[model samples]
Target: MVTWQNIDTVMLDMDGTLLDLHFDNHFWLEHVPLRFAEKNGLTLEQAKETLMKRYRKAEGTLDWYCVDYWTEQLGLDIEMLKQEVDHLIAVFPYVVDFLDAVRSKNKRIVLVTNAHGKALKIKMDRTRLGGHFDRLICSHDLGLPKEDLSFWGELQTIEPFSKQTTLFIDDSLPVLRSAHAYGIANLLAVIKPDSKAPAKDVGEFKAIQSFRQIIPA
Candidate 1:
């Protein structure tokens, strides 16, 4: 059983955890490339391949999230492109129930995401998630990736926290592992990417298909 003792601070991932990731997947893997290709007069496949390479090479760095990076490479106003599909930004099923339960318990919920500031803003606007979190800590603002232990160290300087008394929930294994390495006592990995997926693996930290499983009823 996962204990919630002394867990005053709760850190959560946005995409795939609190929100549906299919939208982001579609945007990056399909929509954006198609739009870019059309705008640049390039083939869709060619545009996707080129953009994918640049993004992959930028992994773990701020440039990975920079709108300017994509704008320069794809020649599209990334922000405007985001606005085109803004309707897709949506909360996952059961996310609000979970958030409500946590709030009812009076826990200090903080949104800790590796998502870029601009993207975060876009998501918050769509989902109104900012109203739920005590603090929205973006990795980009800290100039470090959440998957790095040094980022946690820097976080400590900004806001002191006890790893042993905090709970962190994320969808990515690498990010979860990083949190564990940083000594966060309680970590929950959301399995199935989408909670609706059937017959998925039991998550690493008290595997859950829905947040309602962990948040006290």
Candidate 2:
């Protein structure tokens, strides 16, 4: 579905695109709510119910991905909480091979993530995948979420990529839609971001279950 010959820049998402999304899914849906419930003396169900409402409200916004915002809003040390589950962090299958293949082709590989700096550091420390990328960009650095079309414009000022020759891959459909609207020539979606969760239906955009499908042997 992609024309590799026409692509010069490969923009990748971290959490679900390169790394398994299970850690994040478990953290927010189970771990955080459990801690919140224990701290407030509420039942786990109550905590999840309350937190899910808040999460839905912030969906597609920078606040949804900001550790500091959640920490302050929830009155909990979000960074420390992530560290507690750091062992769960993992890269997806064949991701390393895909990176190697892309690099072998002399493509500019960049990580464009909405993950907060603290979370990014934790995952990088655990996976040691930082050395493979040309640049690491966090949405927090630009004060704009990838869901916002303007984020592409701001990103260009710093990274200077040609929209007609760049390929962007992300698990979040909203972010992919934003990138598409910004005129990114190629867009791919992750159908199975969270390994523990069921596959997703990414309408219109091409989707892949594993990076092996895109990388040559």
**Local error of candidate 2 at residue 170 (angstroms):** 0.4
Give TM-scores for every candidate, taking all chains together and pairing residue i with residue i.
Answer: 0.91, 0.98
Q: Candidate 1 residues 36-132, lDDT tens each?
A: 7898788999988988897799876767667767777677788888888989777877788878878888888889888877889899988887998
CA lDDT scores, all candidates in order: 0.80, 0.94
Which is the leading candidate under lDDT? 2
Off by over 4 Å in 2: none
lDDT of 2 by residue, 6-34 (tens): 88999999998898899999999999999
**What TM-score does model 1 achieve against the real structure?**
0.91
Lowest summed lDDT over 10 consecutive residues: which window, candidate 2? 208-217
- Name the runs in model 1 displaced over 4 angstroms: 194-205
How does residue 214 of candidate 1 score in lDDT?
78
